[model samples]
Target: MPQITMSAPMSKFSSFNVHDDFVYKNVDGVAIKTAILVPKSLKPGKKAPVLVHMHGGGFMTGNRLFEPWFALWFMQWAESVGAVIVSPDHRLLPESSSEDMADDIVDFWSWVHTDLSAEVSRVTSGATQVDLENIAVGGESAGQYSFRAQLSITNHEIGGFLSVLSALTCPNAKIKAVVCQYGPLDYEVPWFTQPNHQRSIMGAPPAEPGKPEAVIQDYLTRYVDVEKIAVRTESRVEELWPLCVAYAHAGKLAEALGRSDKVMPMRLIEKAESLPPIWFVHGSGDTIVNPDCTMNFVNKVKKLLPQTPMHVSMEPGEHGFDGGVPLDEKWVQDGLSQTAAMSSKPGEQFEVRQTSTTEDYTPDPSKSLPLSPERQALVDDILALYSCQPTIRRVERYTADCVYDDQFVYANDRYKMAGQWFALPKFFKESKNERYEIIKNDRDLIQFKNEQSWTFKLIPKTATINAIVSLSLDPDTVDSDFIQVKYHKDQANDKDYSHNGFGFQFKKFQADNVVKLMSSDEVKYFEKDKHAAKEPVKKYGTGDETGQAPKQDF
Candidate 1:
């Protein structure tokens, strides 16, 4: 019922033609989409630069057009810079985790490069075009981490997202500038970890008789397990705001994001070799997310990219104070100017180009190492098994008594294997990238790697199964050479991510010691072998965050 269709809250940008629900990609069969605003002046042949923005809903709830939190200045920037606007809705939390968000980011940028142009042209009847080569990213409150900042609260708090972006190998597209609204950038600070009884912007923290912690559990059960895309997530702030307040009140904002050392995200400032131009907007009177979030992040980023344009639009207001300010206001004009300047001359060394020469690239499964028809057929069947394709029954992929084992899943016989595979849909939304890089090929042996993405329906998050698998075929059974999957003396695993190969066995042992310290009663409740219960390995924040009960600042 919570659909994020376009609503024109800002009247100034009415000149631009808007298109909603451009399906960029699909995750777990759910369509992840973006809302686009193309300037009417953007001619069909002449490419216009692009700006992709993330919306803010305190992270707990808000759709893409959650107009209440829209950064009004984004419109000015689009007009001044002559950029087409693309706003996307990503998986949101208390129900979702930082790991799922990371995938969304990767897939988003991947979509921007591969499919954005065609989508734009199709929507506009080829009257509008997007310049992926010239691009910028910005976001408000929860959106800040989507662009820059150490994400902490309701919280599009994309904890340590910049590090992920920096590691990506996207050479074709250039990240021109970063616009950050009043984002809760530093989660490591006390303001984030401590309870704020006083109202800042969102609303007054929940008063007594409201057990937010308990309410969180009820809402978790009441709401959709995981709203894959933000807009599709029907968010009634009235109902969910308590969970946001409670999360902060209990100093559990850190817990909601999982444990990550990067909540502060200053490591990026210390090690980043080169960064694009950045701008900041924060109100001095801000309380919910202290002004320090912007000042601290800007200060650190300024030090890292001192020559780069590190513009700030500081003023006197609270979080999201300028959402509806008129464009004629001096402060509003000043803020808009700062962003426009960044968009124009993005960096001291960066070149401002309206076009790009690099060819667009999208992932191709067929581009992997080539194999003869027989070898390829064997590889295809093996992948079907990895993806747990139910229709692979007649494919003769796995033996009836195949030894399939994993940390949380155990399926040896075909019956148990089928049950485990079938239960996957029940427990998690499954998506697979069958891209494989064959490592070895022989008369009876084949090895390759496959990464399977899972969004757990119950736990409401994601996990990637990167299984480097090797299958041995009985040379004597030439007919089933490719179809035969056998257990090797040391190469068989039911675990998607190998404990033996990836050094998780040590962590498992360490976890075992901690489990040993727990009382019998506590141990009884913890499910050691349920994939739903297992913590994802890559979720952001410091794992060292200690758990505690509520401590109201009131």
Candidate 2:
């Protein structure tokens, strides 16, 4: 556990400017440290939204300045959205209680609100920046507990010991959003399976063997002192306990008594009706804090505050999504590639096209062709293209006919239906002979669907395509679908590329026809004649007629 020492100020992106080692003091008069990052190009006179972030360390160890990735990712996001990020380091445990930890957070907020108001005001006034109304708080692991405590103080639920400082310091404080990443919400659950029973059998703290009944008696007698114990014993007549001498030991008695009903009891704090939106991210494979803890807490919170927007992302990694399993550089690379592909410059679009030689042309509505070896190979290749690794599951797939489907299964799993397009790659290496014609084109549309799905529409000379994909278990069946492939292509230009793309709707029991097409030219040709009268192309586009090439997925 090396202490965090700030070396040099670094910038993550061009827009994000960071300052390291910003120190602030807590109410206890401890000099706590923090890292502050601000977006450089903000409009003058506007209060920008700010995010206060806490790092995860199981409540025992961690520093804001040391783990720069947490601040870096947050600052990058803030800069992208023109917001500010503040990350603070709180005092660690053994020296601090949960109460003291909560107090430290409130103190940090107080300093930001009052002591640093001039800096905030300068940043906001000099540039039309910062939406003061839209402040957010977030943390990972033990830090999440602190953030939760902050929310509890805001809701007036069992007022945190630090609430007084918060009221005096940041009376106008209002958090718009909260994000918790793999945090422990409950403490009472024992270190072993049967905590309570084990405690009783183990005979309390400073626990030693052969000291059961003696420990209990000494604990009870010390509250009234030795004289009272002797008087009671004399009246009872017969027995004089040999282990009674330990009763006079105040430290032992205190430790024994402290282990009584107070240690790690399950407690719930009632939330306000207008609680802020919450975002939770955890790993399903997390062995440390069970993912159920997050869902359970969310359920309880929603029961009290139904309107609070809650979102959860259970990634493939283990606890903290960093440790345990060996890190997969390919997964990291793929994520980076996807992120880069999603972010396109203004007026630029990326395009992809896929073609196959074995169409065996079938346009007849009622005809069904027997599977040939080549056709079967084509089908296998296409299916193989959609397959994912054990780590990567297919959560959803959408077809062109506005129908969603996920019928494919591997390793006792099936996918769900999503309306947006997404892509999920298999972890296993593809065979040399296996091939699937897949043309996925992506462009940043003005508006996008929240869920994974597929969309296709014909423009005057082009067709708009969109899809959403994700990795999630099937809601109906608890089957694993870790990968999602969403394909959307913009076909506004009547360009002739010898490619064929087919879409299908699949179910657990039956396969349904969605849309199967050979080329965009054929799609356009079908739209031309009244005699043809094919399915009318849906009217959906960003309304910007400028033809931008679709993004190609590599």
Candidate 3:
């Protein structure tokens, strides 16, 4: 593979203002420094989201200024969002032990909460303030010598990033999202512990054509006498990049990085409490770290915390595949679409530059309001009621005598409302609130327009309903709660339209299906007898059966 050389990040983002060499922490007399890049479009006093990026240098070299290793799409996305970029230069390996690097990560979080705002304010000349609420941590591969190090691919970043999740002492520092590209995050995988014959760097022959194990031993012997060499100049760092891959090829990577349990994030992942939305991109053809690392990490995260939204973008190319490309590629645009989907949450939007493939959605700016805590909770509950969230409780949100009429099913009380609502999943596998607009919210009435879809469980067809609703508050509890929907009239939005054949048909079909699926037997979760023999779940494919059945049956 040919070397992908990229232009300076400053030149690409020319409109961005910069501040170089700001010290964030002092560790054992070493002043850990960081570089800040502020977008010019960010106006004065306006809040800006932050992107904390850790540079990739195999945990052995490269400062935070190593822009070539940065992902092209992510940087451009950050620029489009007017994000303040903070790239820290942490302690490198051989110079610092695994514990030291982990400490640096812990300290980095503390610095982010206490001093990051003022530091950014000074950097951008008070043009923008850091929005601590909306923060993302991202890094390119710096793990595995072949370009799979994540925190970017090396043990330093893997340990460091995990340290933030598992060992972080700071309460105020929270990361809303994470973006990792081509990382070997799992140390227990055979790739890190087992030796490999292919000593090539991204399919290129090694500098020394000898056996990988011999080459690794030779390199280890040379560095054995050297004490810690923390920070190096740029050119030297570049030279050291390819050289680090030898240890990984010979299966000495973990041992070389002090062989500490801290380097293994697989051990730490289960301990993470607050999981953030993670975005992972890997080159399918990557010879260094390989895509399995990313897939494994994503699978583990999903298994541990399935609710955390994750997007794994796989492109065709070698490691650093997106080094010199622009942000318009299909993979990049797909990532942008995922970001757009994430924007539905109130303050967790990372709206990036979109390509032509993505559909534009322009919500009415007039309706946007800063809701109070109670009203926000009401909105959340209302959205949850429609979104088919697993955790929704109808009794907690709706009034005892609330009326719900969708033409097919009618309920005059919260008890019946829950029965009809819970019956939704029996007909459809998924129910989603596609587009919602609150028409009115007051003491007497609360009204909204909702466009939603229900996907059939057995068929491939999907039904979209254009529903308009008006809510009447209960007089007794309305003042105390401010949102007790005593009556909810689900009106059809398309009935009055001049030509609504398409819309009316969808509503009719979905409503009819709901009525068909509403029998208590189909939705047995709300009512099931413990003594009754369980219904046998139908198997889709032909299979052998071994489980027991009661002998009383005829």
Candidate 4:
């Protein structure tokens, strides 16, 4: 067992008292350090739930305090929700594999259950003040992956990717829930295998095996013996070669990598049938670990355990929702509130502050004249129609416009248009014309130049004359070629728009098309539907003798 060390001294906050220490003599004889965060104020004879949290960093980097932001926020939540949090500093990569990390957690759980039986009883009995049955496990990134391994063992699966099989199979049946933040579920998925796994295994191209420039070989040489490095290199060929072949043949190498037979079988999910309920938090714009990972797992779980409670929150941002990212505070609170609600007993009280507000304001006629009754009614009608729609208005720039001459427009090989967009002009200017910036802030100026003026037509289905025609520009100068579009729809529009009655109608058209490109899926749907020609006629009910329907219009 590895020895435990606490570098930072424990500090007491208003809501919680944080203590850092090591848990020695782990099950695998590896000593690991852990941190315990206990809520400071608790009512006498009242026990709080326990949450075991793991941090992210792809399982390779990260410590018990890997993400201090989440730690602080979670501590605040624990105080408000009355929960106890335990975060352990597990063994990391290069020194250990993900299995080793999972084993460390299992060992810690055992120690908490058996070795510290007195403390456990004290906490549960409200002497030390911690709830026993309401235990939950959670983590972010690689920590999340390891947490899944723990869940897998609790559900009983043997021998696959990592060596934690022996440790995981011993059921710690007390755990109530599991939460993952942007964790990778399917290791065999192409998104996880190809490019990513390959790069991690063999390093990048132009740095071949046994060569001085080979990064993979260098990394291996630093970590393992020559014999082990040779074995790992050979193993890479055995694992990734078939994956590459599948990718070439199916155009779905990512999905292929995720297939159960390729790496870790998808049957693991089935084995996890009796597992506790799960909560998944992912960023909508996450590219590192595709949101598809969560979507696929959730879909499979829903089929296997329809009654198992699962809540997924898609934040309007990208991976690493800790700091410096646009995270939804409301979404986080809602998730915490849900967790608290689920953990509480029948009559137990759990209070979460809801900050959503509705405004009631009177229009000022002095600043702007009030509209006529008829105009006001028209405005009301428009608002009523769009009230259910999810509208997002943000400034974005037109980075490229591909247009061809009349003769070349019909030519198969004729160039259409393709260009890059950036988030800031300062980056473009700093890059010295190598790249152009798109939209960073609303205050930033946009530049648009006509590389070739082309006619564009956009017709709405509801109204034939509701068409938009604009002169699209092409890339001429790096910094001087940008146009601002006030509104852009994210991929979730279909899901959000479903409430507005338009989402289901447009759902089929949203597939395989980037939000910016319309001619692909957009044109295909347009050609099939032909707008108003397929519109359903509105039916009106007969009115009563009083000249109104039995159900009067509000």
- Top lDDT prediction, candidate number: 3
Q: Give me the runs in candidate 1 sitting further than 4 Å from their true place.
A: 1-13, 41-44, 141-173, 198-206, 221-234, 261-264, 335-554
* Residue 532 error, candidate 2, Å: 38
lDDT of each: 0.51, 0.35, 0.56, 0.36
Q: Report the lDDT tens digits of candidate 1 across residue range 215-235.
A: 666766665455442323326
> In model 2, which regions exceed 4 Å deviation?
1-15, 20-23, 26-29, 40-47, 68-75, 120-129, 141-172, 190-268, 322-554
Q: Each prediction's TM-score against the native?
A: 0.52, 0.40, 0.58, 0.45
Give candidate 1's TM-score.
Answer: 0.52
Q: How far does residue 527 in candidate 3 sit from its true spot (Å)?
A: 36
The TM-score leader among the candidates is 3
> Rank by TM-score, descending?
3, 1, 4, 2
Q: What is the C-alpha RMSD of each candidate to the true structure, in Å?
A: 26.3, 18.5, 16.1, 20.6
| Model 2 global lDDT (CA atoms, 0 to 1) | 0.35
- Per-residue error at 127 for model 3, in Å? 1.7
Writing each residue's lDDT as its tens digit, candidate 3 over 213-252 gives 6655655567544575434322344356545666667666
Better TM-score candidate (3, 4): 3
Which of the two, 2 or 3, has more lDDT?
3
448 Cα displacement, candidate 2 (Å): 23
